[model samples]
Target chain A: MRATLMPVRIADDLYEFSVKDPPEARALAKALGDHPLALEVVAGLDRVAVQFAAKDETEVSRWLNQVAAPEVTHEDAADPIEIHVKYGGDTGPDFEAVCAALSLTRAELIELHTSLVHRVEMIGFTPGFAYISGLPDDIEIPRLDQPRTRVPAGSIGLSAAYTGIYALAGPGGWPLIGRTDAKLFDAARDPAFLLTPGATLRFHER
Target chain B: MLHILTPGLQTSLQGTPRTGYRAFGIPYAGPADEVSMALANRLVGNAPTATCLEITYGGFEAELEATCTLAITGAVGEILLNGTPVHAHQTLHGRAGDKLTLSPPQFGARAYLAIASGFQAQSHFGSTSTYLPAQLGGHEGRALRTGDRLTALSTGQATATLSTPEDLIPVFSDAFALRTCESAETHLLAPRSRDQLFNTNFVAGRQATRMGIELTGPPLEISGDGLMKSAPVFPGTIQCPQSGIPIALSCDAQTTGGYPRIASIARCDRHQLGQIRPGNSVLLLRRTPDEAVREGLEKQTLLKKWLGSALP
Candidate 1:
């Protein structure tokens, strides 16, 4: 059975749709990714908000029906791309504290972080900052009480069930587990962001 | 090159926000007062989306490198041509050494100065608007400074004059009434919070900048708690954080936020937001969804009819 669609009013031009979970949300994103009225699509943990150029209830309902279709599958079609990460060193300042809080050793934390392939849940917070799912629930942590004045670019940060890489250097509170040499965001690049929503990726210790 | 004699508090080249990129966490970062920017471009016979200088709170001056014609719109301030006062709402000419100076904004919070050929500022992602947070676009991706020299993308007619209809100009005042409409979480707010949001008065906070306008007033009460799953937010989204102060997002707002979106300034009345100065009292008046769209369409028709040759 399919999950129930929960539509939330975000703003005059925005309507947010939440389904069962991250995977079900991805299915909804796949079904309605190309609607002309969907000027912008922002995928969240369990929801996807579409900013319509013009608010049309009928179009929204039709789009929701398409998302609710039984044939939709959650997996992204692209082959997983692997990212190189240097974990628990100068690159990650909060790594030891995070490991201790989760009662994990350094090696255990790295193994847990890289054990499974992750999917892009959303790209928000900052330009090119991708929220990736698949961090071990056993070691899931909260964002720092006080955000650092600056979190260097390519730093891997974890909060709750998701982990993300800082695309641009700015203020962020996500607990750093590692850093990557990979360029997360490059304006000169054809695809500016390393991971767009629905792209599957895997992180490995460098 | 147009010599920057003095840069205003915040001066930057403006183009429309980068659309379709919001999903990537990029805010549109366009001109805050699009209507005024359009009028300035129209008067100079430039494309509506052509690059122009958006001067915040005036205090800007520039030297004409070559004889040039330009148009100014938005703020009502002292316009000096070679130290001589020149009137606004009409095009003005300057010789190579002629200096144009604009005093502090007397009526509006921002002003537009569109040169004949539009600015040839550096661009990223096909937009010239400066987004300060990311240090992207404009001259080295920051606000204009005194030593900064700008070049026009192209040269146009040396001399021309045009005036916008007086009826179209939005009057800037200490009191602003923004027609607002409900958002998704508006229903989640406490009944008293809803009443306070619409009926209460708020003074624009000192934290007001291009990104958003912070309002100081009674904190809006809400029973719901916890950060929202980050979602797409527009320029007009009114986010009331736990602090109770409401921040009305503007052209430079972030792509998504976790704050409760209690209301949104209607699309039609958003231009007025650019003219609202900090400390200005704003009233969040209620508006129907139908009325919001109708007014926006009406304004679009008005712009098309008046600037037929200039509009896209």
Candidate 2:
């Protein structure tokens, strides 16, 4: 896999390097051991955001130069976990709205949503929240002009070419179109989060 | 032995935030002002991340169930122990059953009340810091209320007189300088707007919350009209929505936003903005990532030095 590193400064001592994709990011993360800087691999469909702490600008530039083209081991991608969802209606108030905008029926929407295989881009916003990419073009929908004051936890929504499931209930503006009952986040759990960057997911209509 | 006579406004138990929970959208909410909180904690011989009362705009009055060493930091407010004048930011030894009353703040917002051994609260996600939105962490996941009796841990050490005076307490002001770096959307704005952001002074809007602080100033115009894709956001990100006004994301801010971010405040200076109340004037200055990191490290080093010197 070809990898390109782009050095971006977050702060005086905090710097981030955007690797072109996951294979390169995984490789670089392994090569750097016990570096004082905190390493974060921001998951994306085709790219990853590699962030680290820097002592200074000079150190950041030097580290970027030294770590370019680091060796990495490639492993077989994990099997996509199938998540069940109840789409469109009271549980998914925005479901019909989304279908109407796309001029598709409820069944058609469900088929399109379920057919595409998605990769976990990044988990953020709240605990266990997953940003899954790889949606079909016809289903892409824009976010609501006015965000909902309260979106129930586990409410799945599609907005602006991306889809994600909420881990916790909070004020969200995303156009939610479905709900999932699976417990994606539990502090009491050993793993804490069920989804991580690079995890693949497939949706099944419950 | 603080007895809650009235919880007035919002009060909660907080400490250093839980780590490794960022992936779950949980922020390390600990104290808004780490320096002040640390100083208060040190004054009473409590752990640096020990639970303490984070009182906002004070009017909280509690009867002291027992004598203990206490220190108040952040906003400048009238503090009275047993209806007598008490200094802030210095250790005070109160008699058992003394009633401590804190009047509304005259300047600044949020105050830290630290006692020896710290206040005891249930730990959630490895922290006592309360994230109100999730209804998790802190004392029962809610703000302190009247008639709430908070238990304090035993220090087993005698209270010592504080050498620092009340007037010398560290007080953050409204006219604070905020450090910023070019954001991902920086290129999206007019080239001239880049220079204008620093030159323009933005006033804090009344709609400030833990999630974000809205700035009211010269409206910033974006060069591009097309909507940008959503991206991960952190505290200090300055996002410009269609409103033309810029909003600075804070601790309780959303992890991702679609608005064009003109700049991001450095991590260290984020706290300075966090502590500012409504109507506070903020001056934004552009700094290289290197400068921001150096300043942050320097601040951290100074805090460590202060902690070392204060501890017995």
Candidate 3:
């Protein structure tokens, strides 16, 4: 069945598509990413905005009318990238506090975090900062009362429903549980960002 | 080479915006007011997208190490060349060792300084414009400070002296009536509150930054859940936080936001958001999407008359 794309005009050249859930939004975003006229596509949690290269309403309308909604595949075809993490030490100052808040021991916290495969819902806030979805509900917690002045790059942080990676050092409020040596972002690299929307990843405890 | 005697308030190099990277959480960091920047560049014979100096709230002073053709445009009070007053929005000739200074602005908040061949800076993610938060692009990826030295990209002589026509020069007023269109969550607002958003004159709060501007006025209550899933937001997006204060996102705003997007300033009126200062009055006039697009096209046609393809 073709998914309906009822795009609402956001600006002269920008249009937004609101979907029922993240999976649908991701599928729509992936389809729009390949559209010839799309200059850019930003996928939020439940909506996707496509910025056109130019204001060509006729072409846009025709395509929208004719195009079929591509298949919605929650599981990515490629293997999940593994991120090695060092949990619960100086690298993760909030580790003890987070464990206590969630009523779990260090090993249990690490196991719960690494057990599930998380999909990158979006990359935002800062360059290469990936918002990963699929965090277990039982261990979800609020962010720090006061944000840290600087979060080390490669820091693994968790919020209520999402886990994120700190691409570069700056102010952050997410409760950190571990640190990784893998580079999250390098502007000089061809693919400046280590993660992109819809990519699946799994955390591995060292 | 140009020597910064006093860097004023947050002076930096700006040029064409970095595009095609917003999907990776990058912002389009370009000149706040593209019209003024283009005018300044026209006076010095530089391309509209050439790198130039963006000075905020005036009080900038600089010393020249070489003779060059230059132009200053935007809000201003007094322009002094070796203590002799000069005018803005016109081409100027400077000699080696000459000192140029600008006083506080009389109305607007930013000024554009363009040299004959433009300034040279390191490009990051595609443009020379600076993104301060990520420490990317421009000179050292930071604001210009005292004692900084910058070199001109090229030393060619500028085109014949020219002045912006009086009628073409934009006037910065304390009050602005910006055209806007309803956004994703506009209907979520109470019917009375929706009317209030259009009828009331909101005052710009002091918490203004390059990323966004805060407006204070009568609280516009939202009948439904004000918070929604994070969604893509742009420079002109007006997000209403739970505090009831609406914030108009600017060029450096985040790629996405969680606040309810109440309205979006029309593209034609978005440039003015760069000049709005604390305490300024703003009225968000409602317009349909079709009307907003037509206005933007009309404005672009007007801008193309003198600025060529330059559209703010």
- The candidate scoring highest on TM-score is 3
Residues A1-206 of candidate 1 have per-residue lDDT tens digits of 65556566555556778665766565666666788667677666666777664436457656654455335465546988789999988899889988888888999888887888888878877788888887766555766644465788899988777788888786666789889988877776888777887788988999
- Higher-TM-score candidate among 2 and 3? 3
lDDT of 3 by residue, B1-312 (tens): 789999998898999888778778898888887788888998888888789998999999999889899999987779998899999999999989999999999787889999989998989988999988777888998999999998888885757999987877999989988999898888878899899999999999886667778888988887654655668988889988766778898878678766789998887787788788999999999998778878778777777777767453
- What would the per-residue lDDT of candidate 2 be over residues B1-312, giving only the tens digit for each residue? 677998878888888665545545566566666656777887887667678888877889998877677888777578998778888878888778898888888767778898888888877777888877665677787888888888787744577766444443566766767888886668777777677788887888876776777887887777755255555566678887655678887766665566776888887777665577788888888887767777777766666665764210
Clash-forming residue pairs, model 1: A9-B184, B17-B28
What local lDDT score does residue B37 receive in model 1, on the 0 to 100 scale? 88
- Compare the candidates by lDDT and give the number of the best one: 3
Q: Which wins on lDDT, candidate 2 or candidate 3?
A: 3
**Chain A of candidate 3 scores what in TM-score?**
0.74
The two-chain DockQ for each candidate, comma-separated, is 0.43, 0.35, 0.44
Stretches off by above 4 angstroms in model 1 are: A1-9, A23-27, A30-33, A54-117, A136-157, A171-182, A199-206, B156-159, B309-312
Q: Comparing to the true complex, what docking class would candidate 3 get?
A: acceptable
Residue pairs with colliding backbones in model 3 are none
True-vs-predicted CA distance for residue B34, candidate 1, Å: 0.9
Instruction: Please give the TM-score that candidate 1 achieves against the real structure.
Output: 0.84
